[model samples]
Target: MSTFFSDWYYLSIRSIKQIWRPLLALIPSLFIPIFFFVVNSSSLDAFSKVPGFPPSITYRDFIAPTALFTAVFFSSGNAGIELVQDISNGYFKKLLIMPISRLTIILGRLTEVAVQAVMQGTIVVVLLLLVGVRIQTGVLGLLAIFAMLMIFAMAWSCVSMISALRTQNARLVQSLFVVVFPFLYLTTSQAPMPLLPPTFRLIASYNPVTYIIEGVRALVLTGWGNPAIWQGFLVATTLFVIMVTLTLGSFKKALR
Candidate 1:
């Protein structure tokens, strides 16, 4: 049991260090969403005056959570990219042969992803604050939002983890980057669900990403009393469980 944790610690540190070494790898994922946030919020600040939009909030406040969502969600696949590198360079097989639990290896990468979420999420939050966005729930809600985002980051990264394990093809795994577009745009990134066109409204209603966005967005625009936050927690938790299970299965298969 202690050994599992010990393995997780070292492996996680290694993964985190690699991200910071180049640093450039993390920049695009972090900044692109900020640029999007700046442009959209500036252009759509007038949209807040429209009917059916939530009251007492500007467009910047409403879309702040969505920007955070995009930043973290878009970066989730990076762990898989690292895993692919380990495979290509023969380091992964070395770890496989070591005297350690296989599950620990996977857990280590997930931990790294969680740390990445923290770093990226914090940057987004600080940027939001600088832009005059405030969290309605105060410090507690702010912390809770970070917790939920980490779960979300880990859950989404399992896609890349599974891809790296199953295909071992870097290009194929990189191609999965396209998946972020549908999940991001299909949600309430631009406008509230009620304000969306009928087709977009129906689709956003079904996308779990919508709840996750609303959940975090509520922390900024509303408060803890809003049920959207809990729904986000639920959906993100469910996704983490399902994706981690599948990832473990893939890990076991790769060992075979």
Candidate 2:
């Protein structure tokens, strides 16, 4: 146990040191959401008044959580990209021969991703507050939102890691975000469910991102105690487990 933790710590620090470049690359992830927040709030201000929209929340408030999730989903691709670089440069090969556990290598990278996600989530929260979006869930809700973001980030990182380990190609790992963007539009990111077309609504119902958005939305627009919050937690947790299992399998394959 001690050896595993020590390996995790060493790899985590290496990840942290090298993460700044990826964080810089991901700056657009933070700004694009804020940009959309302004545009959606301005253009859709009246849309909230339409029947079926949740009462008492501005469009800005409604969309803030969605924006945060967007940043998270996009920024998470960096983990795989970093892993690919390590492989391409032969650092990963060197690590494989070390006495550390393979799982720690993956966990270390994920730990850094979680930290970055928390930071990005914090920036989004601060920006949302600056723009007049209030958190109905207060301090505890803020913590819950951060926790959820980390879970989501970790799960997405696992997906990214799988690609990195399998392909060992930076370009391919980076391009995974292309696959992620469509899900944002298909989910309830920009509007509520009732406003969506029947087909889109059906798709969104099955999209796990939908539950994640709803969960974060509950913390920001409603309260942490809402069933939607727990539902989102359950969905994110399940996804995390499945993704981690796949990532471990991939890591094992990479070891050979």
Candidate 3:
């Protein structure tokens, strides 16, 4: 058990060091969400006062989760790109021959992603607080919010890892954001579900990002009483399990 944890720790540290530059590159990922939050809140501030809108919650509070989610979604792709680089440069091949468990290698990379997610989420939360967004659930809710972001990041990273392992192509892995961006808009990012156009509301209902955004919003705007919080957690966990299984399968195939 000690050996397993030791390997996991070392590999995670090494991956963090190797990917520091790419992590630095993700600064823009963090900024874009903040910028979106600012512009979106500024434009929609008055909408918060609408009769159906949740009482006392500003547009900033309502949209803060989306901004955090955007940062997490974009940042999660970096691990896969880094993995693809390792494959292209023959580093992955060397690791395959080592006595280390294959799962640890992937977990190590994912740990780095989780760390990045926490940092990115923290920055977003801090910025949101600075701009007058307060969490109704208080500090505990803030912690839960961060935990959800990390889980979301890990799940999304697994998807990217699956792509990297299967294609060994950095370009393909990088293009994932293009695929993810549409989901962002299709969900309840910009406004409440009822406020959305009928067509958009229908689509957002089926979108997992909708649940995630709603869940996080519950923590910020409502509290644990909101059913959306548990639903979002379930969706995120389902995504994590499915993607991690696929990623492990892809990693196994790469070994063959």
Score every model by TM-score.
Answer: 0.96, 0.95, 0.93
**What RMSD value applies to candidate 2?**
1.4
The ten-residue window of minimal lDDT in model 3 covers: 18-27
Candidate 1 lDDT over residue span 1-256, tens digit each: 8988899899888887876867878888898889999999999889999999888788888888888888888768888888999998999999989999877888788888888888888899898888788888999998888888889888899999899999888998899999889988898888988889999999999998888898998887888889998999999999999998899889765676
Q: How far is 50's C-alpha from truth in model 2 (Å)? A: 1.3
lDDT (tens digit, per residue) of candidate 3 on 136-188: 89999888887777787888888888888888889998888788878889998
Alpha-carbon error at 68 in model 1, in Å? 1.4
Measured by lDDT, the strongest candidate is: 1
Q: Considering only N, C-alpha and C atoms within 3 Å, which residue pairs clash in candidate 2?
A: none
Question: Which regions of candidate 2 fall more than 4 Å away from where they truly are?
Answer: none
Reference-based lDDT, each prediction: 0.87, 0.85, 0.84
